[model samples]
Target: MSSQTLNKIPLISLVGPPNSGKTTLFNYLSGKKFKTVNYPGSTVEYSISKILSKHAVNADILDSPGIISLIPSSPDEQLSVNTLYSHPKFGKPDIVAVTVDVSQLSRHLYLVKQLLESNFKVVVVLTMTDVLYKKGFDISENKLSSILNCKVVRVNGKTGKGIDSLLTVLKESLNEIEKDSAASLIKADKHHKTKLLESYSEIEKIEKEVLFETDQKSTNGKIDIQKINESIVVLNSAPKFLKADETSLKIDKFILHKFWGLIIFFLIMALTFTSIFWLAAPLMDLVNDGFSFLSENAFTLLGEGLIADLIANGLISGLGSVLVFLPQILILFLILGLLEDSGYLARGAMLIDKPLSKIGLNGKSFVPLLSGFACAIPAMMATRTITNKRERFLTIFIIPLMSCSARLPVYALLIAFLIPQETPWIGGLLLAAIYVFSITSSIIIAAIVNKFSNRLVKEKDNTSFILELPAYRMPKPMRVIQETIKNGKQYVVKAGPVILFLSLLIWILTTFPNYDPVVPVSPDVSPEQTEILKSNERMSTSYAAYLGKFIEPVMAPLGLDWRVGVSLIATFAAREVFVSSMALIFKITEEGDDMQNSILNSMREAKIGDSDQKLFTTATTAGLIVFFVFALQCLSTVAIAKKETGSWRIPVLQVVVFTALAYVFAFVTVNGLRAFGVN
Candidate 1:
């Protein structure tokens, strides 16, 4: 078999245990911006991209979910294993590029051995070698390669060190695999059916051949620490006795202290939320100004017809309402990514585990819950790490309460209208307080659910909390920027088209059934006032107003008028649609040549029916925020929930319960504020 005889695009799989820098390597090789986190189970699905190699052979590379072994313990692990041998979409890979963390060679070798024994073409790429070397333990890649009878190359995914060498080695290994008919060097028949004990025995034999250490201990008549150390040859410069990681230990002393850790976590989260407003303000202003310029030009060029209105008001203003918040979204992801890459996020999980376990979830659930702030979809997917069915279900059920980035646009709109700009810090504090309220509400709901659900399903006490805290290193700036841009672009790509269409739809619905104003014109009435009256009269008779009126009775208790009701109905598609819908509705209602007149001003001036009072009172704004915080309005989330749960019942139940709760809370908030004379 020659290279030309095989397929043109060779499939290369980068497989490794969790947090072995496999994703970083994948990103480097493929020139793609997949997320890289310092925690386990981050890569839940396989990402396939073309390898940007200068070699003659072009390859399609896959970064699979991290697995400890072929036998799966969780859904992510199962997916990874299935992709390796029997994926429904992508069949088994041609070559398995095993990424080995040099610091944890003994544990990682077990998977390498399994791959070799299973007759998979394997090439070992050693990562974290520098970390291992810094800790006074360095193993020769050549010697390790000779012992394993495979091609081994050292590479740093972050710095691109040794990547060229690894590519050269990969080319040779691929050629060798082609010559050998894509077979493993060591041929063993029926190795896939090898017993667990036999596999361990085989792994032990290899471990003893390469590692070296002093004063190792054995437990339960199993392979001893001495044998594990003897599997790798330690460099002569290595310390005679391994020392504890003093810096991490000292930091952990305070960071993991029960009281201090909790306080620090809250402070960090508060800063993160506050920064979303303070830091993103300038960029948001720029985006707003940019859209304003574009809208003005469109209106000037196209003139005052339907096309001009559609482009300038419907599309530009509507999309801009959502796009201005992109800066905030990027900042949020950047801060979270820094925390994750620095290994502080895992510690935060550890600190919160005890309280979470009390509510029937372990520390593993914390990652998904934290991820909910970005979006509920991936957070729900991340719940696959929870092996306990009941815990996993509970995590999924409560995820939507965390107030994802979709809600950020709505929050920013309402907060800007409600909170004054002069008091920037006050606005930031309000933003932080919203997130705090969301978390508090989620915990209360979880507690109530845990209390009742435990009686129905027997609580499992065997589930343990085991977390790995990677060495805290400076976050790669380029990586942070890449992820920020990638995520921000995703928001635009996913939400932009839907929002534009809905905006256009809303414009049509509000513009039709145009009525001739019969009201007598007065000389005192300005043209702007006349235009406002005509627009309001037209909207009152329009199709959108009819639908809003139909729902107005139901929403009246929450201080929302028919216009707000219309936007709320549109938000069922996505929370961010609320902003665009409002933008379109207000654009039609207000008489302004400038599309840049803050939507906040129009909202403030908006009146409810014949009332002289403003529609967006403090009470109304507060109530809207409450409703959005609790409502499961996203149809995509509902669909994903149904798919993940394998039934419509759970998703339906969530929708009903959350919507009812949102109504009740919103009613209370508005009425309570009104009672306190907060107009």
Candidate 2:
């Protein structure tokens, strides 16, 4: 914590639009990389990185959220604004580097102008210069700098051009930066702080002196999307029917076209989901196996004691649970990025708008709910975009019901263990059933909540949805590589510390009482089996076991014993935790320990029904599956909901409702399946 002992890092903020190559530049600047988290209010977060500059400056270069305007509407935009205006507790950024794309210069200039007016001593990093070069546009750098009254460094973050110059400029600017006079001209009004609009006269005067063009074609012939802006004003003021009619007419030909558009929409989502499952499977297997191996080695090296148990059971198993899901997490983010960058995501929202409206939720709900597949934390965070209190609350309330990526591991583990690969249809059907149940139940719950809650009653005025689709550019290889690393690494850094501690705690709980007092045994047995037996009993004596016992009575009718009960609780932390927790309880100690054999052996050996029958009948497994599918099993989600809603009420409601429904459903499923002799 001591600054004197710490590295004196010079922080630099990189700001830009989506796909502006700002992140690319940050990756090059700092050896570190970042992943996209949806802007704070949205489910997706952008990636960022930091590295030591060649100037011997420890540069913490931040890849900021994309912003379209200074007047913030999205969480990303607001975050960018906040980062710029506020000083971090450590210190203020030494330099602000605003990177802009040449193709989208007009839109990109909005942020640049605002930064200039904010009195921040800024260095302009002009990225995507290669695109400008290819397009035959030429401008004198000196002239451009004079026009803007600031130093402009034209650089390609990709090819490393002008990077050195930009760095030198940054170092110099950090020494004697002065506040620009233009800062006084723009008002800090939320409604309209169009810096470009306010500075147009000065911009025009400067342009005449500095601007030059080569064989570049005039951009005026390109479609002017400004009309869509005017349409939003009219739509916002119009009645619901008129607004609906206008929007439906605008999109009907394409969205609901008899030809390819609808087909394409469906294909995109289908492909995305399929890709997530396919790409992550092998990596997930590796994570699971690797963690198991690490745990065994640690336990073997450390010997039989509290720290060993902590390392093995608490740290290794718990961390393994979190780590196993990283691949899926990365795949989900990558797909989301592709969708967003390709411009298909907004269209998907529009495509589902009409249907979602019929369900009493807005089309915007689709994005958040679909995002739930990645992590419900961000799904709940996304409710800010909902605008309506009732709709927002409704979305937040039902989001946990969706099968989040955490749940995917649980489902995968369970289905693979119980259902055969040859009968994949059965497993697929179960997965699909859970999804269907979630969507249907969400709609029903939203309708019921809407009846009692006072929803925003204003007619939709903002109805026309003509989004600017970025050209179908192949997702840049460098961008994808940077993104994959950022998200993948954070999974370890952000979640790793917590899981490590949890693992230590679990180890302590499961490895105490070296000798078993409950069931007396002869002293002739070998040490290893004796240790395993004692460890097993100690597990029963652990605090986690007591917790399971406390919840067991409530869950008993649903067919779960204390072991299963403990796992269900662990899952609330993260669903994948259930696997490692179960592995710990059963005292299995090897990576790639045949999960199917382990589960079957443990369950078959478990006593029930007057010492003859096995405890884990098919009905019981079915009940467990049903419970996981229906239950709200993520703490991160509830935390995020609390953050987003500015209340504990909705997340509390979600926890209670989902828990109750899961119990009831499991109870019925176990009893009914048994009664029908299906088990």
Candidate 3:
């Protein structure tokens, strides 16, 4: 068949087993950069890319979930099936690109056989062909193509070898659109009928002619399997290898050695929180200052009314709120990435299994729970890794309680306001205490929920923590850079646009219909009296005023006035937006035209209530701290829950439960402090 020009092609779905370089090919074809996690099920969902052919036709290419077999008992396998049979959006694919690892042809061919049976126009894409010669294996591509009744294109997704030829084959196949007759010859039935028997016989003939046997074991493959087996065996051993490896100074010794491991874990956690607080502070201030400068300059250059205020308040402050925390987010991910790539995270999971077991969570729950700290959505998605349904659900349920980095801005702002920074250790202690509180509360809640729920716990004496600690090779520079770039891009792509819009919206709220009420400047009038009237006027007519009033009574017991309440409400959109909200409000309320100094001065003098009391009193600040500490105050988390659970009921319940607890706790803390005369 003559090749059709690339510019006029249809969709091609790339399917393969885990880690078979399917993603690499997708990246090459579509130019879409996807992060590759060091696990089998990295590509949980499908992603599409457009491959521009030399002739100008752009081909729609899809990279799908990794599946070991069509007959799947796991969620990942089921997801693959859904992708194949049901095109929820665009209907069925026009073509299928089946990737097979050349070295692991025997296992890889099983999936190819299944895909061929599905009746899609199959073009076999042989990936990792270099591994074949290295591993002393051989496959006759021409012979295999004849036997399977499909064109075989040898391509290396990694090295880009023979990619153009493969693309040409795809073009040729499109022109013909010939469905292989061999497809209808295989069925999923247990017993072989005439069609199935014929398909098997054909496959056997192809295997005999095309494949040459190899005696050499794959250096990486054997090591990986051996490590997995040893780790699993060690986990279930009678005496346990918990002490360490043969070095007498075992790696797991301090990492998972019960008492020492627990201590180190706590210390690592404490240091993580402390580092977030200290490192993020200076960067946050710089961002705030930078935004303030820009807002003031805009107001000065663009004049004093709506547009100026919008640029100053809405655009500058709102966007600044989200941007200020990027440093912290980067740092958090850096540490996490290192831990993950170094292969210590799984070991950490094993270390915590005994403690998790006490809460009706199995060892598998550790992966999800630890993942929750980064992002509850991914954490919830990770529940699929748990074999036990009860454990999976429990992990998802409790994941939101962990303080994801989104909540960091809210916590930092409130803590800095309420707690005295003069006492560094004291402030540090309080900050660390909050994380401890979060952990304690999550476990207790999980335990209570477990007791009430009737989810059956399947008991099996056979259990293991089998994981491959890939050789401690120096972390690949290109791989790390690639991942960081990929993750950073996703962050911007997924969360950036929403934040940009929200920032502009917030600026508009504070700046529009500017009310500049004149205060009498008589020498006889006291400064306090003048300040009081001006503050009242600002509060009555400002956008924050209207919002704060709506939630005033609900949070009255916590000593929050309309301003703080308004800030809290704004943050419900995204918790890290709190700082920007505060900055915006201050920009609107500033007496002078300068937004930066205006906000700083406003925050500095912010007091409690009427009667000469401050608006940002110690009690209210403490209350806000406690509230953020326990609140499930992130939309992203909720969205993630919905995605993971495949339902809204669980996420809704989480919102209600976490918010109620946060309010109650804050109210008690505030009132208790008042009663004790701490103010």
lDDT of 3 by residue, 1-679 (tens): 1122223446677888765777767777766443333221256567766774543445677777777666654455576666665456544556778888765666678777877766667888887766565434467899889877888999875568888888888888766654432133233444357765665556555555776534453454554566556545754552222221233236655676768878877777667656766886677677766776786678679976657766667766666765766666555555555665555656666667778877867676765675566556566666665655566667788898877766666666666665555765665677678778888989999998778545423334333444333212234345445555565456656666677676676655654443555677898889767765764565467676777688888867787777778777767767767777777665444444344345445776776455467666677677777788678877877888777667786788888988998899989988988899976
The number of the candidate with the highest TM-score is 1
Q: Which of the two candidates, 2 or 3, achieves a greater lDDT against the reference?
A: 3
In candidate 1, what residue range of length 10 has the lowest lDDT sum?
233-242
**Candidate 2 TM-score, true structure as reference:** 0.77
Q: Please identify model 1 stretches exceeding 4 Å from their true place.
A: 1-8, 33-41, 179-208, 211-246, 419-425, 454-462, 515-530, 588-598, 611-614
Sorted on TM-score, best first, the list reads 1, 2, 3
Q: After TM-score superposition, what is the CA distance of residue 72 in candidate 2 from its true location, in Å?
A: 1.6
Off by over 4 Å in 3: 1-8, 33-41, 54-58, 74-76, 102-105, 126-157, 178-286, 331-371, 377-389, 418-432, 455-483, 493-514, 518-536, 586-604, 673-677
Q: What is the clash count for each candidate, in the order shown?
A: 9, 17, 10
In order, what lDDT does every prediction score?
A: 0.76, 0.64, 0.66
Clashes by residue pair, model 1: 207-231, 210-231, 210-232, 211-229, 211-230, 211-231, 211-232, 212-229, 212-230
